[model samples]
Target: MFLLPVLLLLSSCQETIESKDWDTIEMPRVSVHDPSITSVTEDGEEVFYIFGSHLAQAKSKDLVNWEVPFQTEYEDLDNNIILGDIDKNLREAFEWAGKDDADSAGGYSIWAPDVIWNPNYKWKNGDKGAYMYYYSATSTWRRSNIGFAVSKTIEGPYTYQDTVVYSGFTQVDSTDGSDRNTHYKNTHLKKLISTGVIDEFSSNWVLNSGTEYNTDYAPNAIDPTLFYDENEKLWMVYGSWSGGMYILPIDEKTGIPMYPGVDSENQGLIVDRYFGTKLIGGYHQSGEGPYIVYDKETQSYYLFVTYGQLHSSGGYNMRLFKSDNPDGPYVDMKNQVPVFSSTDQNSQYGVKIMGNYQFSNMNKAYKSSGHNSAIITEDGQWMLVYHTRFTGGESHEVRVHPMMMNRNGWPTTLPFEYVNNEYFVSEVGDKDIIGSYEFINHGTTNDPKVLPLSTVELRADKTITGDVSGTWDKEAQSSFISFVIEDVHYEGIIVMQQDETKEQTKKIVFSAIGDNNQTIWGVKK
Candidate 1:
C-alpha cells in the first residue's frame, strides 16, 4: 500500500510540472515621437523615462508598461510641462525658431529632447540635477538651434540656460525680424573666429545661400544626444540632413561644450570648429537622430542613425555602426564607412537593423520604426526603445525590444516586443526549436514598403527549408546559433517568447545578423 501511494504522488508531481505556464503580462502603450530614453531611481525603484518631441514625457518602472506624466499640446503652450510659462522662459529660443502660428506643421517646433542625470551639474545651491538638451527648429529643414535646461528632478519645471548652437544663418535676418547674423555672432561666431575656424565674420562665410548651405558644410544643429564613454567624459552628438552629424566634447562641470580647436591634420571627416567634427551624412542626405551607446561587454561604441523620411509613407528605418573610439570612424559590418562627401545613397551604407515589417500573426504592419534610444539593464540585458507607426494611419506607439549580442559582437533585436522577464532564454533543446516559422529579412533598401513574413521550416536534422535554404545548429547548452543560407553566414541567439498575435501562447524565436550586415528575424508558427 505504501509503494502504490508513492507512485501516485510522483505521477501527480510530473503532471503539475508539465502543465506549468509561462508568465504573461499586458504592456501599456504611450505615443512619444523621437523618444529619447534614460533611467533614474525614484523612491528606491528604478524608473525608465522617455522625453520626446512636442514636450512629451513618460515614465515606467517596467520597460513595457508606461505612464505619461506630462504632455504639452502644440496649441496649448501656456501649460507647458518643462517651462511653466513657455512664452516667458523660452522667449529667446522662440525668437529664433518659433512657428508661424499655433497650428504649424512642426507642432511648436521643439523636437528630440535628451535628458540625463548629471551628478556634476552644479546648481545655485551646489546641488546636482538633470540636464535636458533640446532643439527648436522652424518649418525650414536647415533652420534650427540646440539649447539646454536644468531641473532638480527628471520631470521638471526646468530653467533655460542659453542657446548653444545655431544654423541656417544668412548675411541678413529673415522678413520675420529673425536676425541670423546677430544670433550667429552672439552664439558661435566669436568662438569660431577665436579658434581660427574663420579669420573674420564676412557675408561670404556667415551667409548660408543656395544649395551649398544644405549640401556642403552647414550643420542643421538639431537632434542632440549626450553620452559618457568608458572614461566617464561627457560628449554631445548633434546634427541632421544639412551637414550630416557632428560631435563635441562637453564639460561635465560647466554642463557645456568644450569645443575642439581646428583639425589641422585634416583627419577623417571635416571638422567645423563651430559645429564640431562631422561623423557622417552630408550632401542633403536623409539621415537624422544620431544616438550612441558604449557597450562594455563588446568594448565598442555603437552609433545608431535613422535614414529616409519620418512620415508613415517615408521609409523610415534604423541602421547601426560601431567604433573603438567614442567619436568614431564608425563602420558597418561590410567595412563600409558612413561618411558621405557627395550625394547620399543611404541604402548603400550602414548595417540596416530594422525596417517596415509585418508578421503573419499581427493585425497590422509596422512602419517608420526609427529614431531609437538604447539602454542596458541593471542585469546587463540590452533593450531598444523607439517609436513605431503602424499602417492604416499616422498613429504611433512606443516599443521596447530586447537585444542580444551575437558571437561577432553585433546586437540583434528579438522578434517580438519585450515582456518583462517573460522572454528570457532558457536551455532549449533542438526538439523544442524544430518547427515552422515566419521569417523576415530586413534588407538594406530605404523605402516605405513593408516586408511581410514568409513561411519557413527548421527541421530536426539541422536543416532549414521552404522560403529559404539553410543548415542550422545550436551550441551545446547555450542559446547561441550558427546558420548559413544562400551563401550568407549568420550568427544569432534563440529564445522562447510569447507569440504577440496569439493569446498566451509561447513560441520559439530567433534573431540573426548575416555577414552582409543585414538582419533577419524569425517567429515560430
Candidate 2:
C-alpha cells in the first residue's frame, strides 16, 4: 500500500497532480547498449503498450510512468500455460536465447521496429492484423535488411517475418554527389538487367558521411517510419549514411517502399526515389525520428525529424517541417523550429518551468533526447514524448510530458515538478450552462501498461473513492463529455467520446480543458 500527503480541496494545484502509488511500476533499464524504442501501441482508449529493445513495456491511462510484463507471465511464480500457451512458449524462447550463444547473437540486432494495427483485425480469422516492421543488422552492423513481425496484439510475443527491401547500399561515403563510379555504377548495371535504360540510379550525397561499422555506408540509416495520408497513399521517410534523407512511395499492397532494398537493380528507384532533387534546396540531413501527424482539426501535415548525431556535440536535436503533401519536400514553418531544446526558457504554464537552464551553451543533459513523438490531446492540445536525463548517466530513457503550444504553433514542455504540485477542479455546474464540478480529490493509476497514468498505480477495482465534488454533462445525441469541477473558478472541461468496443465497459482519456475561458486548451488526463 502507498500513502501520500493529502493535498486537500486545493484550487491551485491544477498543474501538479500527484498520487504516490504510481511508484509501483519500475522504470525500464537504460543503457548505451543496443536497446531502443521503435514503436508503441495504445488502446486509443487508455493503455499504451510499447514495443522496443528486448521486452515490451506497458503503461497506464495517462501515458506517463511504465510497467513491464503487462500480462501475467507464464514463468512467474504462480503462472501456468493456461491462457494460450503463448506465454509458455515465450519462456522457452527466452531460456533458449540464454543458453544458446549462436541463437542469442546471430540475427540483426533487432533495429528500428514499427507497429501498425489493421482495422480489419479478427482474432478467429488469424488476420490479427497487428504488424511490425524492423530491420536486422549483421554482427558487423553492415548489410542490414528490413524485416517484419506480426502478432495478434501490439504488445506481443511477435513472430518474425522475412526481409522487406534489401538495398545493398552497405558501402559508406559512396555518394560524392557527383561520383559516377561506386555503388551507383553497380546500381545502374543491375538496373540495366531489370528495367533497361528507362531509369538509371539517380542520387546525391549528404556531406560524405561515414559509419562505425567501417563499411562507409551511413550507419545512421534505417528506421523507416510510415504514415498514410488522407488519400490513403502510403509515404515512408527513412535514411542512413552515404546518402542523406530520402522519401519514396511505398507499395501499399506489400508495404515495400521504393528503395533499392539492398538489392533492387531497379534504376528507377535510384532516380525516382532519390531525395536530393526532392528536397526544397536540400534542407534535411542526418534526419531521424520521423513521425507523420495530420491534424484532423486543421487538415495539416507535420513531419518531425531529429537532427545531428545522437551523442556528438555537432548534432543532437528535434526540428519539424510541414508539407502540403505527405510525399515531401517538407518546409520548416518556424525557422526549422527547435522543438526539443536543451536550454531553459520561460515556463509553458505561468509557473517557472526549468531547473538547470542553459541554451546557447547547450549541455547534453540526456545526450540524445530529441528523437521524439507528439500526440494531440483529446481536447486538441499536444503532448510531446522525449526522454530526460537519468541520474545514472543513461541517455535514451524517455518520458512523456505535457507541452503548452504558443500562438505561432510551437510547444514548450511543462516541467516535472509543476505537475507534482498543481491541482485541477472538477465540478458539477458552471456559468457555461453546465453542472457544478469541484476539484476532484487526487487519484492514482489502474491500467497496467507503459507510460503510467495518474502518476500512481491504485487498486484495480477501486472506484475513484477520493471524489471531492465534481459534476459531469453530456447530450444524448452528441459525442462529448464535460466535467465541471470547483478547484478553479473556471470549468475544468474534458471532451471525450466513448469508444465503441466489443466489451461494453467504458474508459475515459483526459482530452482538453475549456482552458482560457474556453478559448484555449488545458491538460485533462
Candidate 3:
C-alpha cells in the first residue's frame, strides 16, 4: 500500500515524553506563608496573597517555587497591578481605615481574605478583573465586617476599596428602617454586602426544605469566602462565632445576595447557617479560620479549622472534617465529632514534625501551628498551609507541607520524614517516591508479604530482611529497607536514579510503629 506524505507523517507521529520529561520534579513551595497569615494559596501563575490586615503580597512562579516580589498597600497599587487605580471606589473605601497598618486599619482590622478573578468581567486594559474580600474587625474586642478590594489578575496588587459591607446595620443610610436588607441588618454585618467575583461562584438557588434554611448570605459574618461548585454557579459562604457559617445564592447580575424574604417574595432572604447550629456552637470548637475545600477525587467537601487554644502549651493544632456538600454538616472523620480535632491522647497534635523530634529541628517555639487552609497544586497534590510559632520565640512564620488522607479517610499532614530520610516527595509514578518494582525476602524465612508495593524490613542493627536481602546494587537503587525502634519489619520506597538522568523509578514499601511522639515499624500490612 502506498501512503500519502500526510498519511505517512501521521502514521509515524506519536507523543513521546523525553527522558528529560521523566526528571523527578516536585512541588515548588518549600514553606510558603505570610506572617500571621490566615490562608496561603494558589490560583494560576500567581500565588494570590493577603494577610491578616498585615500585608498584601503576591508571588509568581511558572514551574516550581512561587516568586513573591510584589507586596503593596494602596500607594503601590497602580504601578504594580492592572486594576490598581481603576477601582476609584475602593480607594475611597479604604481611605478612612488607614490600611497602612493592621493595628491602625483606621477603624477596620482586615481579617480572612479571598482573592479570585472578577468573573463578571473579562480581562482587558489594565483591569485583569480580580477582586478580594476580607473580614475586618475595628478592634480586638469587637465584631468585624467584611471589606472589599479589586485587582486585575489572580496574582494581584489589588486596589484598596472601601468597606462596602459591614456588620451592625442593614442600610448605613436607613430612613424608615424597612429596607429588608435585614439579613445583614441585625448581625455584625448590619447590611454591608460583599461583591463576590463572578466566575468563582454559583448563580443558583435551593428548594425550600424549611424556613430555617435561610440560604441567605450575610455581610457581617466573618471569614467569608467566595467559591464555585462543579456546576459553575457562584456561591458565597460566610459567618463567624455566634451565627456559624451561612451559604447564600448570589445574583449574577449585581454580584449581590439573592434570598426570599418573609413575604415569600424577594424580601431578600439570607443564607442558611450551614455548619454548627446556634446550639452546636462554632465549626471549630470555637470558630476561627473556617476555610472550606473541595476534594475532586472523592467529590466531597472539607472544612478545615484551627482548633483549641494556641495560647496554651501544646494546644493549637490544625484540624479538618468532611461532608458530601460544600455548605455541609461537616463531621470530623476521625471521631465522627462535629468538628475536626487532634485532642486525642495517642495522636492528637497534627502539626508536621520537621525532624526526629518536634523541638529538634524546627524552631523550639511550637506554641501554635493551627489556623489552616487547604489547596491543591496544579499537579494535583494536596497541601495544607498554616502558621507555626517559631520555636525560639521568633515571630510566627507560615509553612506549607504536603497533606493526605489516611487509610481511614481522615486527613493528615505529611510527615517530616519518609523512607527514613529527612525530606520527602509527594508525587506518584516512577518519580522520587513511587513506582512498581521487585521485593526480596531478607527478614528471616517468614517472608511475610509486604503491604502493597515491594517492601523490605531492616532490623534495629540496620539490616534488610524479609522478601530479599543481598548486596545487589540494583535493589538498593530501586528501593530501601528500613526499621523502627520496635525492631519490627518495615519498608519504604527509596527514590534512586541511574546517575540522576534516567527515567527508571521504584517503590520500596516498609512498615513502622510508634506513638504520636514517635514512629516504630512493626507488623506486615
RMSD each, Å: 13.5, 16.5, 16.7
In candidate 1, how many Å is residue 183 off?
A: 7.5
User: What's the distance in Å from true for residue 457, model 2?
Assistant: 40
Clashing pairs in 1: none
Instruction: Quantify all predictions' global Cα lDDT against the true fold.
Output: 0.73, 0.35, 0.36
Best by lDDT: 1
lDDT, candidate 1, 204-295, per-residue tens: 23434421233356677788999999999888988887668888888776677765554431356666655777888877777888999999
Candidate 3 local lDDT, 1-525, one digit each (tens):
000000000011113211111111233332323222223345434342434322233342322243343322322322323223322423333332223323332222344556544456333453333454443433211123555555443444454444533332322322111222222234322222233222211222111321111222222245556566656566556554333345555444344554422112111223232121211122223434556667677777666654444332334544455667655555542224342223323123222122111311223333456556566655665666665554444245445554544333334444322111123332322232222223321211111122122444433333445554422111233333233323332323232211111221222223221122222222222
Writing each residue's lDDT as its tens digit, candidate 2 over 1-525 gives 000001101011122212112222444332211123333335555444444323223444545345644332112212211112222322222221111122223221333445554443343454534555443321211233344545554544455443443333412434221222224223332554356432443232212342112222223334555566777666666544323344556554445445533323222222233321122111222445465666664466776555444542323444445665665545443232222222312111111112221211123233334455566645555565643342234334555555544323334343221121122223212223222211211111111111211221111232112232334444333323344444321222232212212331222223223222111122222
Candidate 1 ranges with C-alpha deviation above 4 Å: 1-27, 70-76, 101-107, 171-183, 190-214, 265-267
- Candidate 2, residue 330: CA error in Å? 1.7
Positional deviation of residue 489's Cα in model 2 after best superposition, in angstroms: 32
Candidate 2 TM-score over all chains jointly:
0.50
Order the numbered candidates by TM-score, best leading.
Answer: 1, 3, 2
Q: With candidate 3 superimposed using the best TM-score fit, by how many Å does residue 108's alpha carbon deviate from the native?
A: 4.3
Cα error, candidate 3, residue 55 (Å):
2.8
What TM-score would every model get versus the actual structure?
Answer: 0.88, 0.50, 0.53
Residue 217 miss distance in model 2 (angstroms): 10
